[model samples]
Target: MSDERTETVGRSGRLTMRDIARLANVSMPTVSRVLNDSPLVTVETRTRVLEVAQAHGYAVNRNAKKLRQARTGTVAVMLDFASHRHGAIGDPFIFELLAGVSEALSIRNQELLLSPPGLDDTRAFEDFHRARGADGFIILGQGTRDAMLRSLARRGIPMVVWGAVSKDAGYCAVGSDNLLGGRLAGEYFRMRGRRRWLFLGDIRHAELRLRYEGLCQEAAEDKEVTVEYLPIASMAFNATGQTVSAYLAGGAQPDALFAFSDTAAMAAIGAFRERGLIAPDDYSLVGYNNIPPAANFSPALTTIDQKTDVAGALLVEKLMQHIDGGRARSILLPTQMVVRET
Candidate 1:
């Protein structure tokens, strides 16, 4: 009987759970349970079934499973195109954060759907969710869409944001302590006795605003310490570089500088270099998001680490909780300083 069943399975074009069950010498229900990751199946039986399925190169029909469960088992990850702009998607830190989110979702057997740019409006977000496109959403940055996100949350949407957490935010968020990061940068500048500090980033961004506020708070302690902020509308490398270059052209020199992103900081460095200025010699510099290139840069940037991997895991976990009909609060990850040459 075993030989006959094996021969029949071999003749079939595609192997099914029934074939897997017969090969593993288990009941059809047992194979089904194992495939569904149900705890009802014994470990030894589950192992045998999986091995048989793998041996036959079987693939599960995810669409059918989603229909049965009435859940998409996919998460939509939205980027703030309005703030970062199109080219800014190439930013390494965004890739790192996305990688973290993808890794976390894979462990949970969830799919990641990268939402199209310009979905910052509440209507688009609602349309996507209502159409069963994703089980939930994980927004990469708050950008200037905080109000839109809040509206979605009030409508009982399952979503989590990666940004600075506000006390009255309706939606759950997971992010580093921006205020603390900025303060650390401020303290570092003060410790070196560097006055005339400059900040380069768009304060319209919630996260960057918090960073600027923290730096200002620390600089206010000493009247001699002055902090000036230049709001760059776009975070693109060329745009940021041009902005910094123009500022330097105006003879607005600062002894120290802090940028909200590593990319912006590197751009500022290049801009200053054009004006015969160098980091740690002409001015001390600090940047946020300790991306890989930060260490490889000419000056080896001093930066605040946002713990991207942990933040990713937390974002997925919190979104899952929200999907399961549970309340998940915002999480603020501790920020750490990575002091290098800059």
Candidate 2:
């Protein structure tokens, strides 16, 4: 390829503050200040420098730029890859939080790099800060005592944990009032004359802990009601079927159920059907995070609307403001209940 054309194809391969300054007829420091959006440069000087640099097709290498100035103009987002890719991502609660982040980032011309989740290497945070200068991070899903996060915290990695992170100052969090969610579930069941209730899904997920807490709090007010918590970890369709059989055979059938999530609600509903029972007919039921499929279900579902789209947008907004000279802050969006057939 021709040198000129090749350089155009690889702007990241060639451009630097030095080159920009050289073309703009300014000192390297002057160009550097403008690149960092420093107000020290007068408007005339800043405009002239920028025009010259742009005319010459100068571009900033994020890595090199960050190394020089300690910022990549980037924010990292960690998501539950397993859930997001599986079409199970949106539940009202999770959706709203993510929307808030995404909207905030978009206005500031920033992006969310949804880091894949896994049980693999946990030292990724250390490597991230070592090479690239990331100003901060936004953790989206359920990751606990992560090595990367801990190392980053030990080194003072600025971050906002949506529902992750300990309540330590090292981590800032924006999470739903899970206790409220649980209470709402319990209230819904109690009002419907359900005294014996069942709960489904793993209690290990961080969010579930909050949901369960909320339900217990509300159910405690009612003396006659009892809430049973069940774990289905590592259990598949057939195994879950057998587990459900035991519940029926043992005569511990619940008058109502409040699942930790919509998926779990569906799973429970399926289990109920397997035993020739109908939800909200033979027994009342309520679910959380009225996801799209919740409405499409055979009897639909009664649940909470956590507003994920708004949350995702808000997350983006927060990232953008922080990138553009804003200080860190925590935000909480409200939740509402959505009543349907079930």
Candidate 3:
């Protein structure tokens, strides 16, 4: 082939994979397979081809890449109302989770399509199964009464959820051990001689409800330790702060507080300050998710770490299994405590 036809340089003066293969003393198809990250290519051959490509500054052509890949290669990410209703979708925790998912997809040569907020769940799901837009769907958090999920499962849709796992839900899910997390928080409080424990966060959602149940169960054996549940009307900082303020104003004194998220826990701390109270002194507080900002709070937060990185990777791995016509089982990652001032 002519030099211009087979080895045109990109804006960065790029070398084509053909040129790379020639320089690395390998077949052109071998170079192509390595560039596409095909596991069929031997490790030593892939390393050599990649090293040569890197040394020569070879870059894949975008247009050619588009034509090479079959259909739209993407996974649809849908944030259900259970997570978006309180605006928790934009929280630091969610951002971390999404970053993990994005990284996992990048490594697998796929893209992520985030469904528009407030999207009709049925329509988005239909697009995944019928319209052939995304290879599969990943629901960030399942809303209460997931009837739509059941219907789609009956139709044999390939989807995964990042929330509570229940046989009744009838969907493959990947989530942390919320029951263990809540029990840990409650047990710690009881061990510290806390009498009144307050549970914060909405229990209507399956995950929060599981955490609530776990906390209540932990305190069940202790007659002296009383556990109370209060729904977070909204996840907004101000809303959570106001809710805590109202509870304090109503003469409810909690010796320990187990919040559903770091966002809620931090907001409650601010509310406590406004009410002339401090954590671990006046009361002990535990938060979930261990988001980045959890450690920066004034009293720092004691929280349950869900290991977002691992969670994200597992979610993608399970989704890929379903997409490839394999059965994807539910996964429950372990939780650990990050003890800070609170």
Candidate 4:
């Protein structure tokens, strides 16, 4: 956080409020205190700020020599702004993550500035990262290598995502082994005396592919179990009613079924009821991401506990490390099975 290597954006080497905040990235008010040489800033924080400012080649504006610094003790959690048409398909999971994110920010005596879902180019997400009020961002339901990810990298803002395709890229990511969750699904059914399994959900997503691959591998060992691939949902993975009914209409009654998401599993169960069939008896089932609604369904769903709250906490830790000039990478949390009646 030294300022000796600093590069100001404009001539005269004057720093803007936003620029100063970005330098601190972890918190704006902290940076403002440092700039003002106020007693409010701890010696440790003041030292870090001076180093960052000096490195950025910042020169105080002699004209406005005594301007009060800008610092708004707040951080942000990035929403998958694109997926808000139905009031957040992932709202429950998001709420749980926020609870944890807030708990962490509170330890620093800071608050979170929430950004609503919006429609814009990648710049929208980039704006979230550059906000003067927020310390940085904790992105949920999205991954790195996304358009926003690339833009944030260019801005050098402290950032982290719930998940990412690669762990070793520049940004921070925290997610579970989705493939391992899938393997667990296959293993669960194998022990239940059920074979002829069908997998459903968006096949295009890398998460789904990983889960499917694991399921396939586990199902292979059991000659009595036949795992079938059923890419039911297309553009909208949530559109599951008709999709599930299609396979049912084809006269295929797989003894077991695994879905990529809890919603998909609910849809599958709904289809069974319409056909006068009972779950666990007629067809054993399993779903991933132990989402809230999954447990409340008529037949409580068996699923994979994704530990999304843990992922959120890990994400903030990663961003903090990167802000400290440490190496950034992905952190994988563990997953487990939540076996319920259905």
Top lDDT hit: 1
User: Would you estimate the TM-scores of all the predictions?
Assistant: 0.87, 0.71, 0.79, 0.69
Which residue runs of candidate 3 sit more than 4 Å off their true CA positions? 1-71, 81-88
lDDT of 4 at 288: 80
Instruction: Give the per-residue lDDT digits (tens) of candidate 2, residues 153-178.
Output: 56655566665224553544555666
Which structure is stronger by lDDT: 1 or 3?
1
How many clashes show up per model? 0, 34, 0, 9
Query: Would you list the rank order by lDDT, best first?
Result: 1, 3, 4, 2
lDDT of each: 0.89, 0.66, 0.81, 0.71
How well does candidate 1 score on lDDT at residue 202? 84
Sorted on TM-score, highest at the top, how do the candidates line up?
1, 3, 2, 4
Clashing pairs in 1: none
For residue 253, give model 3's deviation from the true position in Å.
1.0
Per-residue CA lDDT of model 1 for 210-284, tens digit only, reads 999999998998899999989887888888999999999998989999998998999999999998999899899
lDDT of 4 by residue, 262-320 (tens): 76788778887788878888988998879888888879999998887566567667767
> Model 1 Cα displacement at 163 (Å)?
0.6
**Candidate 1: where is the Cα deviation over 4 Å?**
1-31, 42-59, 116-118
